[model samples]
Each structure stands twice: as structure tokens, then as C-alpha cells.
Target: MAKTLDELLTVTAPVDLPSYDSRATTGFDGKKADAEKQLTQLGEELSNLQEKLFAGGRSGASPTRVLVVLQGMDTSGKGGIIRHVAGLVDPQGLAITSFKKPTPEELEHDFLWRVESRLPQPGEIGVFDRSHYEDVLIGRVRQLATPAEIERRYGAINDFEKAFTDSGGILVKCFLHITKDDQKERLAARLDDPTKHWKFNPGDLDERMLWDDYQRAYALALERCSTDHAPWHLVPSGRKWYRNWAVATLLLEQLRALDLSWPQADYDVEAEKTRLAGM
Candidate 1:
């Protein structure tokens, strides 16, 4: 029997970041054209499941929801996943939040306060471009917070995720893994094309200089926060097409596990039909 994608990609134990090949498409052998074709095939089932999920939530028939938390270094294609994968479902069914530097008001509250506010509603699929993990990732790397404070966040995150799962929410936490060489090439492309200049940032180079530090940060975050309820999947994102396909497949598997059905009519359907005929 074939292994499931979740089984293939999920971080079951502590990972040695240096050992893993970011460019290698782990567990998948199909070419780019094949991946794209598979993605198109995934669309109908994904759309149907999303519709059922949305309808169930809209009518207060189900409390189930999904939150896809995407975390990675710059140039990791978080936006691309949102555009290609989430685009397979209805736009109305998705709640995407692209986290940036905290605003003054956000800074005043606990880190999770803003994150909790932006969670997907019952039946919606929430996608976080960058998420609460930043507090630990950049927070540790940049020494933005006290050591003790950063230490406290790991347990806090586990508890928060536990509560979410206990409340019928499914969390899909993905770490988009890419190689340093892969990133350098991508950044170079951004600089080479005038049309892509808008995507280029000088500060990205500064971040690139701290690549080893960021990898350590990510490794720790993945090891600590990948819980039983919300395990993190390390996606090899060196190939854009495979990344899109894999994320979509992961989501499809989650939605299928829900076994959603069209909500039953709340009123007398036969009577409504007669009434409509009379009208």
C-alpha cells in the first residue's frame, strides 16, 4: 500500500535541518506537468467539500473549521499556496491573514490575542501567511523578547492548539522548506526582472545573512510546537508546482476526514415545493 502524504511529510520527531534536502521532493516522484494535472483533478472534490463546510457553518449546523498556518523564510511561496490551492475553493470559504510587523495596539496585548481574533469561523478555511510562530522564530533569532518570555511561549502555544482542537477546529501547520541556494536564485530572479523588482527587498539580504540562525529557529519551532493535535508538515517548496499540489492534497485529506454532507432542509420541503407551484 502507498504511504499517505501526511505520514510521508509530518515531523514525527526532532529534525536535523541540515540533513534534509530542501530541493528534493520527498514522497512525490511525479514531474511538474503531472503535478499540475493532479492539482486540476483535485479541484472539484476540494470545491465540493468546501461548499459543504461553508453551508454547514452558515446554517449553524456544524462547529467544525480549519486553520492552515503557513510558516517559512522569505521567498518560501506562502502567497503562491494561497493563490493556487485556496483558490480551488470558494473565496467566501477562506479567511486568509498575512501577518506583518505588529502594530502598537497589537503589541499591547498578548501575542495570541490578535491571532485568536483572526481564526477561521465555523466551516471556513483559515490560511495564515505567517503566524503566531513568528513570535518564537524571529522573536528568538532577533532576541526581540526576553529569554524567559520566549521559553514560556512554547508551552502556551501547545495549550492554545489543544484548546482549538478540543473546540472542533482542525489546524494544518506547514513549514515551507527551501534551500539557501534555492532562495538565492529566487532573489536573484527578483532583482534581474524589472517587473519583479517590487517583490525584491534589500532587507531580505540582511535576513539571508542570518540564514543559519533562522534555520535553527525554525528547527526548534517545528520540534517544540508540532503537537499530536496539530502536527507540522515540512513541505519541500523548492519546486513551486509540487508545493501547491502537496498543500492542496493535505487540505483535501483533512476535508475528506470531516465526511461532510449537504445540510438537510430545515423546513418542510414537500410543502415548500407545493407552495412554490401554487405561486
Candidate 2:
């Protein structure tokens, strides 16, 4: 049997992330039609919650922001999740960054330097398509950095994420766990459809060759960096629809936990009404 999202979290939430299945759809028993309906509803609720978070300054406190970091292999639906789930929110309250190869300047500084400037402001939700973890994942798999350097980066990542949360940022890290066979199918589908031909990269196959190495790197990254403040979660992503739904649900869970409310109006309602009536 598949596990519920909550159940999956309970089992995978440990700092040392246990092995997880990538295709479990345990909690959602509904059909596709039902899932779509529920997704629409979730979209609405997400919008409302975002509005409250956006207007947080009206209540005279700095707004609590959230940063959702997504990591996975190519063809893992990171783009799809951003378009489907994060797209539902008001863009004014959202900031997104997709990290690519580092520039000469970026290479000169520490790994986190390029990441610092892209952080979401107060009352905003930030999403990283691929994040600092790349320094460890690709950095390890490709030997861009030595084993000692990779280990040091793990420590740096943990400290950075912890400080982010301590400074009123809520961090949600998700590893879109997809199987090798599933990836091959998706890549083939991309090739099959002319519209998606632009999405296919010849370089992805190169990375695919080092799948086992990448997986080991990921396991180590998750285990070391999944801390109390910014824990990691594995979102089963073999199914595209389920991946979108699960990401949305996970975000909703975090937003709701903040118990955000509309900022109280500073002006007197009755006085404003009287003044407008007189005008």
C-alpha cells in the first residue's frame, strides 16, 4: 500500500533520511477528476494564504517568508511543479531562482555567495529550481570539488539554512524522487513530442550515466543537511499529477502552520465610513 503524505513524511522526516519509494500515491484515493477538483480548491486556499502573507507589514511586524528548494534529476518535473503549483500564487509575493553553471565571479567566492542575493523579501515566497545543493551533488559526482570540499559544503549548507530559518524564513526542501526507468520514459516522451524537443538536453544523458554516484551523493546530502529548522522531504514524483498535488499539499501544510491572518487595519473603520459618507 502507498503511504499518505503525512505518513510518508513521518517515515522520511528523520535527519538521516531512510530509503523512500518514488511512486507511492498512498493517501489520495480519488480519481483524476476528483484530484483536479481538489487541486483547484488548494489553489484557491494558497492564493488566500499568500495574500495574508503579502500584507503582513500592515500589522507592524516583519513578514515571515518561505523558501521552497526543489532538487531532482533532469526530467524530474521541477519545471512542471513550478508552473502548476507555484504558478497559482500571486507573482508579486513570489521570487524564483533557477541556478545554472556558476560564472567566473561566482566561482571566486564561496558557494553560498551567489545564493544570498536571490532570497525572497518579507511577505514573499521564494522557490529555487536547483539550489546550493548542486555544489555538493554535481560537485561530488563530477569531481568539481574534492571529497573534503564536498563535506565542508555540507556543513556550510546546514548553517546557512539554519540561519535562514532563525531569521524568520521557513525553509522547505524537497527531493523529487524519480526512478531511472521513469526518467528514461520521460526523456523519450520529450523526444517524441516536437513541442518538447526544446526541453531535451543531450547533456542530461551524461549525468544519467552517473546515476548511482548521484544517488549516493543525494543520500549523503539529505542525511547531513536535514536539520530541525530546515528538514528535507522526499516527494514521490513518478506520477506528474501526484508530484504537483503533493508539492501543493506540502506547501499548504507549511503555510497553514504559520496560522497567518490578514493584517489588522490601522485606520478606524467607522470613522472612514463616516468620512466617506460626508464626502
Candidate 3:
């Protein structure tokens, strides 16, 4: 029997970040070209299911929605997944949010208040480039929040996610796994090319200085937050094509699990056809 992608990539055991290979294409034996072909093949199916989901939401027939939370170190290809994987579906059905630094208003409330506002509505597939986990990841590393406060956030985040899932949301949490060497090379490439200069941030290097701290933060987050309701998947992201294909495949699995069908016409179809012909 073939293993499911979820079974292959989902983080079931406690992770030791340093030991995991960043370039591994686990469960996929294909080359880059093959992965790209598979990603393209996923398009029609993704689009069709997305249309059904959108229709269900428009007609208020279903509350099912999907949320793809992407968290990774810089240059781990979060934007690439959104552009490739989420792009396979209709743009109308996707609500993509790239969480940035908190605005003054956002700072006034509890950390989750801003996140709650950005969740995907019925029938939509929501993608978060960087998400609430930032509060725990960067927040912990930078000591932006008190140590005790950071500890409290783990339970808070778990409760918050449980509530979202209870309300008919499907959460696909992914942590794009990459290595320090990967970041160094990518950043160097960015600096080497003037056109790519905009992508580079000196502050990113500042964060890189504390790479060990960030790793500890991430390991803790993954272990503490990988609950039954919303387990995180560790996606090896050094290979961009494999990362894109893997995420697309994971999404396809979730959409298929919904078992959605084209919504039935609420009005009489034959009568409508007859009326249209007469007109």
C-alpha cells in the first residue's frame, strides 16, 4: 500500500531540527521536472473543487473552509508555495494574508485579535504566509513578550485553533524546513543580483545571528502546538519544486477529504430552462 502524503510529511514525533535534512523530498521520488508536471496536473482538480466550495459558500449551503498556515525561516519558500500551490486554484476562492509587524491598533489587543479577523470565510481557502506563530517564534526569540506570557501563548494558540476547527474550518499547518546554509546562499544570490535587492533585508541577517535561538523556538512551537485537531507538517523546502508539489498535494488531499460536489440548483432547473427558452 502506498503511503499518503499526510502520513509521509505530518510531524507525528518530536523533532530534532538539526538532524532533519532540509533538502529531502520525502515520499516523492521524482526529479524537479517531474514534480513540476505533477503540480500542473493538480490544477484542474483543485480548480473544480474550489469552485464547488465557493458555490457552497455563496449559497450558504456549507461552512467548510480551508486554512493553510505557512511558517518558516526566511527564504524557506513561503511565498513560493502561495504562488504555486494556491495558484492552482481559483484566485476568487483564496484569501491570502501575509502577517507582518503589528500595527498600533493590533498591539492594543490580545495577540490573536488580529489573526481572528483574517480567517477564511465559508468556502474559501485561506493562506497565511507568516501567521500567529510569529508571536511565539520571533516573539520568544526577541523577548517581545515576557517569558511567562510566551509560555501562556502556547495553550492559547491551541485553544484558538480548536475553536476554529470546531466551527468547520480545516487547518493545514505547514512548517517549511530549510537550513542555515540554504539561507546564506539565497541571501548571497539576492545580494549578487541588483534586481533581487528588494528581497534582501539587513534585518534578516540580524535574525540569522540568532539562528540557534530561532531553532529552539520553532522546535518548541512544533512540539507544543502539534495537536490532534491541527497537526503541523514539516515540509523540506530546500528544493523549491518539491516544496511546491508537496503543498499542492497536501491541499488536494484536504479538498478531496471534503468530498464536495456541485451544489444542486435551489430552483427548478427544467422550469428555468423552459422559461429561458420562452424569453
Model 1, runs deviating above 4 Å: none
Off by over 4 Å in 2: 1-7, 10-19, 57-60, 267-279
List model 2 lDDT by residue over 140-203, tens digit each.
9999988889889999999998889998899878888898888999999999999999999999
For model 1 the local lDDT of residue 173 reads 90
Report residue 7 deviation for candidate 3 (angstroms): 1.3
Give per-residue CA lDDT, model 1, range 141-192, as digits (tens). 9998999999999999999999999998999999999989989999999999
Residue 203 alpha-carbon offset, candidate 3, angstroms:
0.5
Candidates, ranked, lDDT: 3, 1, 2
Clash totals for all models, in order? 0, 1, 0
Model 2 RMSD, rounded to 1 decimal: 2.8
Q: Please list all clashing residue pairs in model 3, or write none if there are none.
A: none
TM-score for candidate 1: 0.97
Worst 10 residues of 1 by lDDT: 20-29
TM-score of each: 0.97, 0.91, 0.97
Give me the displacement of residue 273 in model 2, in angstroms. Answer: 5.3
Clashes of 2: 1
For model 3 the local lDDT of residue 3 reads 87
